[model samples]
Target: MAKNSGRSRTGRGASTEPARKPLWRRIVRGVLVWGAALSLLGAIFLGTAVFFTMRELPDYTTLMKSQTGQMIVVRDRDGRELVSLGPSYGKWLSYADIPPIMAKALVSVEDRRFYDHPGIDALGLARAVYVSLTTDRRARATSTITQQLARNIFLNNSRSWTRKAREAVLALALERKFGKDQILELYLNKVYFGGGAYGVDAASRKFFGHPGTELSTAEAAIIAGLVKAPSNYSPTADVEAAIGRGRVVLGLMVRENVISQSEADEIDFSKVTVAKEKGQDSVRYFTDWALPQLDMLLPENKEPIEVWTTLDRRMQDAATKAIDGNAPKGTQGALVSLDRDGAVLAMVGGTDYVNSNYNRATSALRQPGSAWKLFVYLAALEAGYKPDDRVVDEPVTIDGWSPKNDGRNFAGEIDVRTAFAYSKNTIAAQLGNEVGFGTVAAMARRFGITTQINTKPAMVLGTSEVRLVDMTRAFAAVSAGGTSVEPYGILKVTTTSGELLYEHKSAQGQVLVPRYVAAGITDLLQTAVATGTGRAAQIGRPVAGKTGTTSSNKDGWFLGFSSGITTGVWMGRDDARPVGGLSGGHAPARAFAQYMRVAVARRPVEPFDTELKLPDWQLEPDDEQLQGEPGEYSYYDENGNLVHPDGVPGQDELPRYEDGSVGPGPGPGGVPPGVPIAPDYGPPGAAPPAANRELLDRATGRSVDDPGLRPGQGAVIPVPRVTPIPRATLRPPAGQQP
Candidate 1:
């Protein structure tokens, strides 16, 4: 019984004790399982990177020889380089011809262990991490030359580790496909070297004016330094900074033992020809305008070609200076100048192309204000109206819309020519209604106004939106003796070998108006420049232009031309807000004068048209002796005081009509003592209309030009009101009859 109990106790103790666990199962198996899980995660990550980075790699072979990658050079009319677009590349350099020292310099600075790394430099990464941990300076991480090439060729420089992993995978792929030297060759040929130069060959040519094959140690170091921060290290940006970077590169080369310290010190960076950064070319305004038209001219021609344009660099500079100096701040200004043949000589789109690239000259559409009167007068001339004919400047309603003069200062019974020169809004409205509004729109369209013209009474005051180019082009037609012209920029497109691709053929649009009509128009415009609203636009020469100020001064424009040259200037806010006290004769006309002075300085002073009665330059009548003034063009001076041209007699010098029909002068603040500005024909052989009889009876018991006339007064909206003056009765009031 004792033995049985002892055995049972031992058995129970043995059963109670657990089996001894194996150390291999507890540690090795667990480690293997965790390692497998980690490996699976890494596989998934690598697979995703491969799919994203390698999904569609560019055909590098095709890119190497692609015409699309070639640069196009644009030349001014003088054959000087205006701009260069597309990838700037030089001669393709193979690895065999590359200098060992050049490669060493780049390797020393950009990638120290470039040759030893399989694809990614782990040692470099570890060293970078160690430096980061130990010092305030942080070394560059894992973007080796190969990795940079991969990213440059296939991936974007997105600031993320995800992109880094993709860059790493691409680097591995590139290394597997190309040998180290071949990889270096591709990298040297594809990397951006700043200043719009891409690749080592271009960089070498840009910085040294020599090919990559002729690079010296200093130049090579300078080029190598650009890989990190091209703009910062570019000698063009700051020569001192660039040379310092080059010195650092040289030091790195010396440390790598690729070159001795003496050899590094012997390098002179002073001789390095740093390319100038094209910060902003005022000519860029013209180039920007012309570049896009190239695609349309030769859509199929993509080879590297030289575009010889019609831009006169002199005029471009003048235009830019005029706009920058004169245009008020917060207001955008634009100018366009055309040669006699309608070749665009100069264009200033805005104050600075760098700040705002919007080409206001061609793109912006705004109201032309009184400048729209050109079309009104042209339409009237086409409808058998003569400049010297009599036209009453009186307020009448069109569908209950009444047109008022600039300051309600209507010159009643003035000659058509005088009224037009004065920019009498009521007369213009009368003429617009006399000739159908559709006729005015047709005239505008015939003269290159491609915008939609609203054929309404309001069209007379230029309520329609029109581009500056449209106005310039329209005026160019008048400058061309009425033959319409299409403004052209690209004169010819030829390859470097002089292979003709495209040449501008003078496709004259059409003869918009007769030469006599053009001469009459010139006569009126000259009068305007002489004693009218555009007096500020005169530049000691025979210049003719119209001034247009929109209601509320939202837009100001001066479209004028001299012999063989026509230009347009516009000043306004882009948002269509009012420029306080803005007038077409103010900033816009001043800018026009400034630009045109330079543009015409060298050219001979010529009349607008030899046959046209241009303003008599010698007519300097004494202001006191200038008696019986029929009318005068008026404008507000810089001081905001309403004034007239020098020696242009005011209302006090007013004359009387011969037909005994007298009313008021066109001077500011209507004067109504009954002074006739021109000879009036006897009243029309018909009873006067209700409105006409009332106005005529009040104007001068003389009578109406046409009692049946219902010439609608085209209202310029938001007219500035005038002070009401006490009317002097035509007949003596009850006892004062003359």
Candidate 2:
């Protein structure tokens, strides 16, 4: 019994020992799994680093050779570049090619340990990390100059973790592939210096009007400051801020031992001379207008080429000064100056492009108002109406609608010149009807009114929308002796390397009006400027123009042409609401006068084309011959069909003459007994017509110019109120004519 008890105790102990074994084995397995996971993670990290390091950087040669870039170069008429555009695809240069002070300033501002590190410094990384975590910004990460260059050249400027990783990898790769000098050269050459200038060479030339190697310490420091934000630090872009930034750069140069402390301190950054040509050509107006022309120049590839335009730099500067200095408060203005051939010389779309890019000179379309009257008078002249012809300005109504003059009253009698000089709406409306509204509209289109023109009779009163550029171009046609030419800004385009790829010569189309007629029109417009609405536009030279003001005076425009240039100025609120009391002859005219004063200062005073001298009669249309009842042309009604109401016979019939003796007018049934009476042709309900059957027969084929026919001759045509045919009247109440 003792032996059996001992054996059972041993088996129990053995079974209990298995629990300890299981605990130890589980611990060992857990440790092994953890170790394997750690090894795999380490491999992944190493593999990632290796992959990035092995990736090749983008080649600089290829970047320059690629055809998907733009380099906009703006030049003056004298072929001096006002500015150059260099956003991408720019060349690379060496640090030595840049001013030494600039090199030191960049190192001082960006990477203080640039020369010490291969690509990135560990200390910088740590500091950057701490700053990033605290400041909540990605730029807190410190990238050496080499690393920054690598990122700029090979990686995008995205502030992301993936991009960061790639940037580090590329930086390391760049250090490994290139020598320190080569890396510095690439960075200097590839860095952007803002204001559309790229690379050390281009930037140096842009900012200093000289080579990079020759920049002074102050200028070099300013250029260095541009590395962070070129637009923000450009002296021309932000003078005070750029100067302040330059001081910071100079301070860094002192700390970096680039220059003596005294030299850095003595640097007179207070008056850091801003490079005149550093900023763009102030060609905001031309830039907008020349875009479409550029598209044609480079139709195949979208690569932007440098354009050399006919812009006069001095003139552009004068224009900017004039517009900014004299523009009235609370009012916006636009000025466009194009040469006689339609080459834009200077254009200021607004007083300032930085305030708003909404180009008022080219984009805004306001009512031409009286400026459109030029076409009105031009059409009248074309239709055999003389400038000296007499037209009564009494109250006139066309189909129950009466148009008022500017002040709602008419002058009794005035020649066409006087009527036009005073802008008599009644007389102009009369002339429009005589010439036909469609004829005036067609003439307007020919003279460059691209928008829809109202063919309604009110169109004679200048109620149509037209863009400033189109208006300028149309007026330019007048200045160019009636030969219409497309307005152009770019005269030539060349590659940055001096390849003449495109050139624009003068493009002329058909003669819109006869040369003598053009001369006559010019003379009349000159008269307008000298003594009438455009008197304010009178410079020392002969000028021709018209002023336009919409109803309630919301928008005002003055468009004029000198012997050498044509300019258009418009002033208005953006909302198109009524300004209520302004006249086109006032503000817009003053602006024109201001701009022209500056323009004529440099130009030689020249008279208009005197070769086409006019005999007194040549300027006026002939009045001896009748202009053929002013032919009532067919026009579509709302339904788009032709109808002549006066020609169509209604159901009402005439009374039978009864052996050619007069009798009471017939009724609707056409009998002499119980003749139906017609209403009188006076005030709403005064007429008691005896169904005047004789009136209808007498009105048949009556010429509008028939002298014997008095007012209210033709029967009122019952068609829509499109034409101004007079209402029918009874035969002077029975015996006045006999």
Candidate 3:
């Protein structure tokens, strides 16, 4: 009974011990089961991620063909590079050629374990997550250098989950495809380093004034630090901030054993010198002018292209020098030169394109003043008038408006050629009226004056405004024997692969003006240049042009042309105020002369074609007519005596034609007005017989050689005489004359 009680107590005591096992063993068993299950879940998640990432990955072939940016190279007509516009990326450096310091600085500051990682750093990521959890801070980026390169080369920078996943996938694929050196080389080249510089080489040159391979430790660190915040830490833009960031890089390099602490301490950020921004390139004006035309020229092209232009570098330099040397202070100027085919050889829009981009050469409508007289005289030539036709330069009023000459004085009975040479405003106005204002306007349009013109009589004095290019084109038409030409700059366009995109060809069209008329006008303009207002524009060669000064001297213009080139120059203040009395015959003409001397130095002097025929009336009036009254009605005999209706010497003559007269009557030779005078019809020194003259007049219904007639008998009508008449009396019945 005792033994049984002891056994029962022992069993109870053992059972009461609560099955005690080692505490560590129990905990180990539970941890093992849970850990295994979690590991399985992790494995599945990683496998699935790899699957999706690989599926979204771009083919390596596509990646190889992709470009980070497009490049546009503009070359001059001679195939010389004028300017390069785009994200400037210097020559690509191979991995081996990259400076060791550059790579060291990049790796130390960006990713210390760049070589050891696949695409993501496991230890770094864990630390980032742990800091976020414990310190209540958001997780920091743990992207490896490879990841950054992948994103920069192929992906958009977005913070969305999808973009991040794609970036990670692309990064892993990049790492798998490229070795560590290849990845680093691409990162160094593909990264943006601010200031329109892309890649290490360009950044080094831009910020340090040196090439990438020659960068020192400090320079390398300075550039490397910019990758984090390029604009905020640009060495040229924010030196202090950039130095601060660079110090951080130096300290990191020290920590990574890339440099000794002493070496970093001895570095002086203050002594670092960055390259100065270069002066604005002169070609920027041309590029700015050409940019808007790109869309129309290459609407379907999304890739970059090269444009070959017709800009003659030598001529451009000459024009620029001319403008700079001649433009008065506080005033702006523009110059445009075109070849005979109307290709823009040189175009200078302003004295300084950096200060202003307003391309006055192609834009900026200013009144052309007397330079516009070319069209007026051209209209006159088309209106059966000859260059030698006599015109009264006396002040004349039309519809209550009187236009005066530039000198405010008139020379009586000047020939058309002499009047034009002097830029006679009164004669131009008179001719404008005689030919009709509408006819003058139409003639100007035919000459390629695309601007709106006023029909008022003052338009003969260039009251209307026109662009320099359009005006230059007009003059070029005259230079080209009246053929119309559209000015062009771009000669051709080609892709980087040498594919032809566009080529400029001259447009075909009928001549805008008759060759004879152009030749006649050219002759008159040449006379002007030779002895008149444009005398300052003589270039030791045969050149023709017109000088124009607007009212009050607000705008000055000298538009001239050589046998092979036509150039137009304008000077004025932007505010439209007077240029302190700078006339077109002064600075504008001087600049034109200066440019033309250089432009035509190699070309031969070519005189204008002047073999055109002239009408009998336009021939030099008989020596006696030179002494006639300035009035339009006066006629003179061969002996310088005023002639009368009876062909007798007298001071006053009867009206040449009467009111409502249809034909002229016998006076001198008795030839009708419309009848063509035979080349040798009359004796040189003797008057025709009266009986023969009377017979000729009866046969032709009028006298062709008649200089005067009764009030109602001739084709030439006098100004109607205003005789005072009594007021009309009202009559009580119709048909009653009061």
User: Which one is best on lDDT?
Assistant: 3
Per-residue lDDT of candidate 1, residues 1-738 (tens digit): 435555554454556668978998889888999999999999898767655555455455754544325577788889976777787766668888877778888889888888888789999889899999999997768589988887786678898988887788988766665689888888787789887777888788677667799887888888889988998988777889889998999999999999999998788878777766555766787888888897789867655678899998888888988888878779989999999888999998988788888999999989999999998998776544567756677776655558888887766677768877789888787777665555566678778887766655777898888999989998888888889888889989887557898989887567777776788788888888888999999999899889999999999999999857899999999999988978999888999999898888878987766353322221113421443232333433333333444423355544445566544555686445443222121232211111222342333211223222222345222221222111231112244222
Q: What is the C-alpha lDDT profile of model 3 across 1-738, one tens digit per residue?
A: 435555654455545456778999989998999999999997788667766766765664454335556656677999875765676666567788899999999999999998887888888989998998899799996688987887887678888998787777777767776678877887887788988777798798778877798888888999999998899999888888988999999999999999999999999877788887655645677667765676777757644467899898888889999999999999998998999887888888888988888888888999999998888888778655677666677777765679878878978767788998999998888777665555566667877877776666677898888999899988988888878877888888887556888888777645876677888888898989999999999988888899999988999999989867999999999889987879998999999999989888878888887556544333223422653422222334333334432343332332243354333334587755632222222334322221233353332223222222112222132212222111131111335332
Collision count of model 2 = 7
Over 4 Å off, model 1: 1-63, 66-75, 79-87, 90-104, 107-187, 204-217, 229-241, 252-260, 268-276, 280-288, 300-308, 492-502, 610-738
User: Higher-TM-score candidate among 2 and 3?
Assistant: 3
Write candidate 2's Cα lDDT for 1-738 as tens digits. 344556554454545443346877889998999989998997688556745665654465554434324667667779886665546333334555656666667778888888888687888878878887888777455678877786766677887889887777777777776677677777776677876666677677766676676778888788888888888878766888888998888788788788888887787876556667543334766676776677666656444466788777777777776567645565667778878877888888877666677888888878878888888888777544556656677777664557887777867766677777777777777777665565666678888878766656677777777788888888888888878857777788876666778888665667888676676567667777888777877777888888888888778888888867888888777787666556778777877877777776777776765234444323223421322122232222233222222322223432334475444443476645422333223443221221122342232221223222122223332211234323122112233320
- TM-score: the better of candidates 1 and 2: 2
TM-score for each model = 0.65, 0.67, 0.70
Give, for candidate 3, the lowest lDDT window spanning 10 residues: 723-732
TM-score of 2: 0.67
- What shift in Å separates residue 412 of candidate 3 from its native position after superposition? 1.7
Q: How accurate is candidate 1 locally (lDDT)?
A: 0.76
Best by TM-score: 3
How many backbone clashes can be found in candidate 1? 3
- Residue-level error in angstroms, candidate 2, position 619: 16
Candidate 1: worst-modelled 10 consecutive residues by lDDT: 722-731
Screening candidate 2 with a backbone cut-off below 3 angstroms (N, C-alpha, C), the clashing residue pairs are 93-189, 386-621, 554-579, 678-689, 679-687, 680-687, 680-688
